[model samples]
Target: MRLTYQTDYALRTLLYLSCLPEGKLANIQEIATVYAISQNHLMKIVHKLGKLEYIETIRGHKGGLRLKKKPEEINIGALVRMTEEDFYIVECFHQQTNRCLLSPVCQLRGVFQEAMAAFFRVLDNYTLADLIQDREMYEQLFEQKLIEIS
Candidate 1:
């Protein structure tokens, strides 16, 4: 199953911040430019993340955004869970679904549930730190540009 754009951006944003120097802040515009995403859309994800306390924002001069906690402190599974609202693998899994004829007999739900658990298990294995540890490689790939403060 593919994750939503919001989830994708959220992950990218988190990873970007995790890769930055400790206590350093990044602006939303810079993140958008680096990731090649729309500033408007990124803002929405950033707001949601800020609300979840995954990232914090500061306004005005010398202000930008930073991860609220260290990379190790963030859980990948939990982060995905926070960003992704709908995890239903099939129509039958939803609450408002029209009943499928095989709802009672089909083992598909259980199977899907197991698969979902496995997906989360894999994500849980990696923390934000794990994703950002290859700092030099990522810096080369994205060519991170630091903003100059006057």
Candidate 2:
């Protein structure tokens, strides 16, 4: 199943933060600029992330955002689950909205369910830290963007 833009942005935001040096913070504008995303949209994702405790937002002029937990502690599967609104890959998957008369006998639904389970099973094995294993690479990429923006 494809993820929504919100989930995509949240993952990107986390990745950007993960690339920062310890104790350093990043602003929403900077992240938006770096990723070429809408600042307004990123703000909403940031708010949700903060509420979810994935990132911490500090107030004041000098304040910024940073990860509240270690990268290794942030499970990718868990984060996806939190950020995603629903897992209804198929119409029949959503009971309330489903209109398929074949749902009861549909083996396709079971296959999709198993596929989704396997997908999550793989994501469950990874953490934010795993995604940033090439920390230096990501750091250089982000730094390059900052340099260009400057």
Candidate 3:
């Protein structure tokens, strides 16, 4: 199953923050501009990330966002679970609204469950730090130092 734009943005946001030199701060507009994403949408993501304690935020003049935890500390699987609203891969996966006739004898449910587990297993293998191991390449492409957190 494909991840929603929200999850993608959250990851992007984390990546952007992680790539910056330690203790650097980036404002919403700067990050949105860098990724060519909507500031409004990024604002929601930033807000949730703050509440989740994944990032720290400060308001007013000279205030911005920074990572609260190291990139390696951020678990991709856990992030997906937190950001993904639903894991119902199919109609049968949900008991309250499932109407599939094969619900009584479907092997697809087990398969989907296994597949999802595998998906998380793979994601758990990496972190934001792992994603930016090629930091020089990323920095060259982005054409800036971006942000840093201490």
Give all TM-scores, in the order shown.
Answer: 0.90, 0.97, 0.92
The better-scoring model by TM-score among 1 and 2 is 2
How much lDDT does candidate 3 score?
0.87
Which ranges in model 3 have alpha carbons more than 4 Å from their true place?
144-150
Residue-wise C-alpha lDDT for candidate 1, range 3-114, written one tens digit per residue: 9999999999998887776767899988898888999999999999999999999998999999998889898989999999899878778968747888878898899999
Residue 148, model 3, lDDT = 31
What C-alpha root-mean-square deviation, in Å, does candidate 3 show against the real structure? Answer: 3.9
List ranges where model 2 is wrong by over 4 Å: none
Q: How far is candidate 1 from the true structure (C-alpha RMSD, Å)?
A: 3.1
TM-score for predicted model 1 compared with the true structure: 0.90
Please give the distance, in angstroms, between residue 9's alpha carbon in candidate 1 and its true position after superposition: 0.4
Candidate 1: clashing pairs of residues: none
- Tens-place lDDT per residue, model 2, 1-150, is 899999999999999999899889999999999999999999999999999999999999889999998999999999999999999999998989999989889899999999999999999999999999999999999999989999
Number of the top TM-score candidate = 2
Candidate 3 local Cα displacement, residue 108, angstroms: 0.7
Ranking of models by TM-score: 2, 3, 1
